[model samples]
Target: MPKIDVLAPRSAYDIECETLIIGAGACGMVAALSAHQQGEQVLVVEADAVPSGSTALSAGLIPAAGTSIQRAAGINDSAELFARDIQAKAQGENDQALVDQIATDAAEVIDWLAQAHGLPFSVVSNFDYPGHSRRRMHGLPTRSGAELIDALRARCEALEIDIICERRAFALFHEAGEVTGVAVSTPDNTQETIKCARLILACNGFGGNRELVGQHMPEIKYGLWFGHDGNKGEAILWADKIGAQVTHLGAYQGHGNVAHPHGILITWAVITEGGFQVNKDGRRFWNEAQGYSEAARAVLSQPDGEAFAIFDERIAGIARQFEDFKKAEAVGAIKSSNTLEDLAEQLGLPAQALRETHADLPLGETDGFGRTFGDVPLSAPYVGVRVTGALFHTQGGLKTDTSGRVLKTSGQAFRTLFAGGGAACGVSGSNDSGYLSGNGLLSAMVLGRNAGKA
Candidate 1:
């Protein structure tokens, strides 16, 4: 329930700006910076007391190809290869034009952040994400989303950009098909209307809205919601009122291995680095190599809708690079033992079944689930963490052109409206299975930059 206030000609406003952006996450922040770089006075309004959104909850990793970092690391990748990876993972269900646009613009965005904003970004060359054919994942030194947001916020501060926090935008005012201003309310119910020549919506999607999630993504409706609470689909609602085109409302990014009860994310690196998941009965159910988004459904279908991620010390060392994994270890969510039997006893799983499952791991050959294990088997000192599925964020919303202009139902662009991040339809196709790692931030930063530059 968001409403659009139709305005007459020559309406006055208490405040004004050349470019106004809603939501202070990666998308909005980047848009603000890009607009400012273009000599446009910009203002950003955030719903929460701070700028933390779904971006802060993530690993802060962005996948980009053909960057200077990639070249320095001697890795060969191109925008075309990245687009093919996205298409192959989504099974060709996504818009090829949109995919190509993001893929092509991603490297430039990454380079811009580093060169202009002084963000210390480097490519992650250790291991490859599920769908990526190259090691193009990039992150800061800490590999933390909070760090990324902090860096962007610092840059905004240095540039003297104005970001107003604790202002929740409730209504959009427009004349005909062109947006004129937005109405925001404070926590104390004080309301103000700010006029702008152009408006960008980066408030993210509806994963946090229970009603909308149940309506569109009922399959993961009952699962855990791990996204920002302020993501209530207000952007999508406003788009609907304005007749802006929306598509793939059911598409979302989900995770199969969130530490249960601890509410901490166990990095998917453990799984990709030779770890396996088992139900309470200690049995492998599906092909875990199919990507973490699809694993949400596979894990939810298990007994009690819960499972345990089993890995060895070597894998744990690799996962230590992630801040979430360290937090998970701090809270005792991760359990380690010198033997599988001891680890099974600690996790309350059947010892015999756990041993048999471990013994059955194929070496140099694909298993029944089509995952091939390496020649090196998991040695002693086993580690495990109790996990459950979670819906991270919705991938579908208002459809926009490559320049990030919101499009009408008749395929015409709105005069002064643009959208990015979760507010716009992503390249994940129509389901969770199509979500490649880092696709969320990929869309957020790329589209946000494009929208501002346009």
Candidate 2:
């Protein structure tokens, strides 16, 4: 975990509430809002000045089935289908009951956030994310996580829930082995104990902690960490101290193409639309169709820890719908050339190597990396983005039940202790390859609402 300060003895309670939430991300805010809606007093504390966690860095997509939106779109879906999809992608290594619960509750939670809470979410159609059989993803009008967080924060404010920002929660406070509250260190370096009837650990995972990353997920330990700095795995560490069972510690979401210097996420739509990645040596290294999270491993193992996303104008037009793509283009993160030789000269790649690579783009022709480019050859005017792999967020932490109660090693619920969002072990199972798109927020919002309701 990120280096936490040793605490001094707490003398008295600084605040008390019915429900205490650690972290102000989507999960924490949703939990707080849900609890407040139920007429319970809630308090949320954030480690940073504002409430942007990895959720704010995401595309704000949440997968759900049987929602009003889905039904209105005439797409048939069921919780069973959603659970099966998750199990298929996670290789059946997930908690079955939790998966079922998330699938069942996802639509209701998102629909509530939209209709009642005024968070404008609409079902996105005509496209498919990796590991989903149908169009089950819902996103904001802006398709930005920052906007989603703002909506949740506004709901919390409307409920008059207290949110303490820039305060770091260090440890859990317990009485007679029952979790009761949290110990927080404020910006002034003073220790304050906030006692509560229930505690929700939403402090995210260890993507930013080098030691924890090496210990749990050594495969991507050396990859660039692209998550929030405040995600120091404190929830995992503190819950472990209280005998909380940790599961799926190696699971994470890895982005294959984070445009360098510009730092904008290069959408995988480029690859799905017939774009290919090449090593710094100007050669295909792996099947680009493996999806982003899985392809990250191949990208990291490249010759110089670098790769380039090469696509034609047709694919670029398809990808321009994403805000990150628009921003990347605005910042000059993408370059274009009308010819392979000009493209090679502009990007410093081998012209002959690039030309030869495109010669075999016909259907049923497999490249050296076992990739079949069935979409025919890429058009003349080419677009390319210099890219690198990055760890976006961890999908593992404290194991919880269907209702979001943190479970002990003996399989009993830890009384008064709850976890969700990045603080909870997710549906991604035991490794990075199992990560399906939108799994992070699915686990977060579903479990967060569950914890608050319980």
Candidate 3:
């Protein structure tokens, strides 16, 4: 067993440790494990109970680009190739050296997740969401995010790391340009201050915090469906108090599928069949027959980045051919109507345009006798689910070098502030998310492990 010393502050106890990590998300958890394994005294303080935040809500996909595991599985991919596809998506905005380093180290990250956290992941082919030429993603079991988090939690518990839950980090302590500790408030209006030598801010996004979202990603400011209930942007506020810089505040990730009011989430396959995507006026915007990824891009590019996936009963059933889409509807995204007029009235789209465009699509494909709508086959009973822009998952945060050390604007190192996962800027330069299984998770794990070592 690794010698673990969980330096916890009980009832406002002053604490000291070699490494102190905030948030218990996948990145924080991985960083804790790596640091502890390296003989560093580690303490982790979480704002919520088990599995709270984006790591709990992730698809559990980790794209370790190239590694021994991938080699053992005979998936012949290279670090250079992975970097190329990511650069293409970014249109050359990302740092070339950083991108290459992450690509080369991706596979090792996957192996660590499995070997260290006991994540039972498998290689997924059809991993191409919108980009990437190779099958370079890893995913958990059907339960997805839960499985990965469970493994991480189990490891944390075994290590005896202090995982203080139900405590909110109200402020960070700093001294002379260095982060020192955090001030936390419990449910009962009691304040607790914990101190440490090295502090890591892994606290997640401000998506659930409406004010922060409004200030940062103003376009679809209110349309985020953070699967985790407590995605308050404490990290941004904390970083600000400590003189940390937050970059890419304007860019927020949006998904093509999510439910309404309750804001349940869904997958993009809903529009793959003959369902026509309609803009505000209910006119056809993009070919619904295209792959789910292309559809996401097309929808986001629409007027104000809004559209509804119009499909009938037939299209819904066809989309259900894939089990994930069906399960996604359980979380929201699937809408229905007994007749076309009801759907049109509900979504406030032009009824005639919808009728004219989808009138030719049959509910079932007998022998694939269609033009393959957008180069991908079409199927359906016309269905149109209204989808608005969503902060799908953050693609960037604090700027960091490939090693996960927070970097200065001058391409130098920022003192002690290391970030990984969506909390850190993605190695990918552009706004588009690659068809990556584990890109975000991999970034967090590999870089976080590196941060732990540092």
Candidate 4:
């Protein structure tokens, strides 16, 4: 018989632990750390490298509702109030209970990010991203995910948590009705079974998963929503196989942006911060600060979720006109145009109309005509990026309670399965980016920690 015969009598590489976490992104990493601290032996098995996935792509701001920070800041928030706010604001879309729990712990999670990782941040009370309440956003200086990952990675390593990367989990292990472990496809194409009394499905969403997207957000059937190619709804698929209940199937966040040559749209975390948008004809769109989410809706409602990121050498010249477009330029903010002809041509707009359109307009800034990066709009180097909207992250996912407990389809508890972060159902889908701060990371940290602790 061949060494790898038909059934090979259950592999010898099986392993066991107290908790087995899938995906090592922010959510999974935080969950592992939390579970480990609770005296549970934890293991994290990821399909990619550690600290990768959407967490790597995220801005990494952890925002919660009622915490010492929010209280001290005089933000008057509570779990009940938070839940009500999320539910009410979401228009009965996202899961009320989960949103409530996240709001409950919003600030403490950010505090943990600062205290645990030395990630510096300061509150911008009355601050607004685009959608949420005024100035409640607490911002990190860097506004990047690397800072948060550094903290999470170190903690997991110190706790001696086993992090197995490139291991593709194929099936959940179960006996009777409880999920006991998972069967994963190893890098060598071999199989291994890992065991645990508890499992955390922090593998993220189906936004990148075409099948999932098509089935749920059918409006996006032909729509483009920039998402990781690797996110194929494996978590949702796995959840389904285990008979786990899933809801909020139609909900998804819109991220409209300029499409790059890479098939990925170059939208922004906050266009209201940099500048405003203009159609291909050099016509200004909506109010810059008024409902920045209008961009998301506006972009999607168009022929394509396409728009030209209109900026001028003049606004580019204004250093403080915006944040720091120069640094952003170095980081590849968007494309530019000097003469409207070239910009229109590059972005597929009518050149004569664009020029004629601007010829009669006031040359100086008038309340908000074009991009105001800073200074006097430099000179020529005007730019624009052809962009579109993408699914970003799917809002609907596994249902959880106020404590991040995985709720069964039957409205009962699903033993050993807990979900949070993007993998969990319920998000404030008022559909505005740059509206609030730290929602993704904060939700993960707060719920992940609580679930582990519970």
Candidate 5:
């Protein structure tokens, strides 16, 4: 039911701009900034009063190779290795050319944000994500998506770029296969049409649309939708009406560790730092190191659709860098105990099964799931959080060329149409398991930069 209305072009408009961007999230903001840098009159519109989308709900880290932040942190990484990591994780299911382009352009995008926009970015060298070979994640001081969005919004403000919030674009107007303008409505149901030479769709994916999720990704249809509510498949709907080529409709990003009832995101650092997850029965289910995106189905399949993330104080210390983790702690979502037995009792898990599960952690060899435990094991005092699986956002949308130009089914580019972020087919291939850490922002910012440059 939430679809973009396609209409014919009108002679006049309420506003005009050289380039118009839909959605004020990371992708849209980046595109607006990039276009502004090229002396293009850019205007950004958002459905909400402020720019808070899926990016704000994330950890706000973007993976980039060969960045100054990485060099300053003494990390040796390159675009080729990053591309290989993506391809390996996706099992070569994604487009190699697009992967390479995104990988190569990533560092430039990071550097540009810091030097040009004055966004303080630093490489997250504390630990490596699942598929990445090196530590290349870059984030702001808070290491939160909200901080990233605020910084981008501030940069837009400093540049005098107009960002009109609370204006939802509901209709797209085109003439002779070229996008001409869009129809937007305000909170009071007042309508306005804006004409633009070029249009970029950065409105994100359809994870919030229950019907679209049931149609494309029924696997997580019943799971919690943890993304922005405005992501209702408008970009995909517009693309469909315009006959744009779409691919990887089933690709999405899922998480297995949203704090139950509190609804806060628990960073994967707990698991990566030697913590483990157990079902309500206090039995370890699968290899958590396989990556968080695939863990959604694993966690959801358990009894009662819930699990407990078990970790120690040292791991919790590392996780404290995330604002979400701190919020979860403040809200009492995290429970701490001095011993495994006490922790099991607090979580209502079977003490004996939890002890056996903890004892099975291999120190030398790989476990059944091929995850190797380090010499340092979880010790007292122990910490645990009740968590459930959630659908973060969809990873697939309109198929585009390397430059972020939306293409028709016949492989021809639309003269004035572009897409980025969740509106574009991502590099995650065709499934949740293919998602690497920071892949969502990678597509969002890089493709957004491309669209703006175009």
Candidate 6:
């Protein structure tokens, strides 16, 4: 079984640095690059050979207002509007300070990445994601997270920052309650102590830990986890050991339509563009417009943990803009048929119920599930994929201030300790319901930058 690397050290080799970062995912990579740009000596360590985490698994949709791209696209958005959307979606349960800080710093960060680091980000105005009133999302041309990660890795390489992989960080070295460094174990089981003036935890959350998931977020115990196994809640564990206050342990991001067996995500753009979901009985169960993450529970509650995503050719063409959806089509993950009955037969569903659902969709008639029909009507060449719910990543961990300073229960900051990405409490509220689109990457990038700067 694949498991997170957690080891006990019996020996130590002394190494020193000005800043030490753990986990080379988007957060750690960005933090290292930002700190290095600021003329600070930095080092990064990763448990995996390469940095493949939730960031790489994501669709790379980053929501930020007031960006140069957004302004060029003629969008009238600002940090206050973004912060309002976040608080409203989170039901006012998240840390407003952190939310405001990220919103305010979002444009600067994106601009810096584009100008200073040569990252290509453009405004996405064609479609809207959940909880956002504007088209402020920006990403690469292909909108691929792998591309985003590759870009960050390239910048890190150019900066000549050393990223030691396959090394597990198990313990923190502290001096009188202030973290000074970390204890890392090599592939050969050799242990070393790397002392530093500052330490940032970007290792991410505990989604891979079955016990931790069961203890904190039991509702998702049966869902599929489609994130990196290296995220073992090392930051949470380490922080808790030192009296750091943790929050939103029940919060997580989930997806309602991950193509089964193919292991590729079916983009929610299909649903927003007039696609629909049905349970095993071939009947619409809920409004798919609720967004993928929020609608995950409905799909998870279906019998045998199975559901089918149904869309027409028009929506398929629109969704093909996403690389994963196109790949799903190429691998025979998406099944297509010329008629509703044929599609239902292929899905092993009742032909009559499926036909009736498609027929009534364009008539503006309300079904038992109350799904409002859009202008696009289902016709010949129906497209679909067998899908299941997935637990993407935990959105909660160590609670920190707006500046990424990890705090204690008494609200005191750890002088030399900071955290970002999955290692820190995300902007999502106390459960899975508060995850707005791009919350994970937003928290990761903004908080990572703050930690590096501070």
**Which one wins on lDDT?**
5
lDDT of 3: 0.63
| Every model's TM-score | 0.98, 0.95, 0.78, 0.78, 0.98, 0.95
TM-score of model 4 vs. true structure: 0.78
**Which 10-residue window in model 4 sums to the lowest lDDT?**
1-10
In the range 293-391, model 3's lDDT, one tens digit per residue, is: 334456667776677776556556544534445665675556566666666776677777766655555444421333244433332333556665456
| Local lDDT at 304 for model 3 | 66
lDDT of each: 0.92, 0.85, 0.63, 0.61, 0.93, 0.86
Q: Better model by lDDT, 2 or 4?
A: 2
Segments of candidate 4 deviating more than 4 angstroms: 1-13, 65-85, 124-127, 138-140, 262-270, 284-297, 300-305, 311-328, 331-384, 429-438
Regions of model 1 farther than 4 Å from truth: 1-10
Candidate 3: residue 323 Cα off by (Å): 7.5
Q: Candidate 3, residue 339: CA error in Å?
A: 11
Worst 10 residues of 5 by lDDT: 1-10
Off by over 4 Å in 2: 1-12, 364-377
**Candidate 4 root-mean-square deviation in Å:** 5.8
C-alpha-based local distance difference test score of model 1: 0.92
Clashing pairs in 1: none
Tens digits of per-residue lDDT for model 1 on 79-187? Answer: 9999999999889998899999999999999999999889999987776689999999999988889999999999999999999999989888878788888888888
Clashes of each: 0, 0, 20, 47, 0, 0
In model 2, residue pairs whose N, Cα or C atoms come closer than 3 Å (at least 3 residues apart or on different chains), thus clashing, are none
CA displacement after TM-score superposition, residue 2 of candidate 3 (Å): 36
- For residues 1-454, write the lDDT of model 6, one tens digit per residue: 1233323322444888998999899899989988998899999998888887788998887889999888888999999999999998899998788889999998888998999989989987777787898888888888888889889999999889989898888887665677767788788888777878888999999999888999999988888998888778887777656778999999999899999878899988888777889888888888776568867788889998889999989888878878899899899999899988888888888999888777767545555666566665877799888899999999999999988999987789998889999999999899888898898999999998889898
lDDT of 4: 0.61
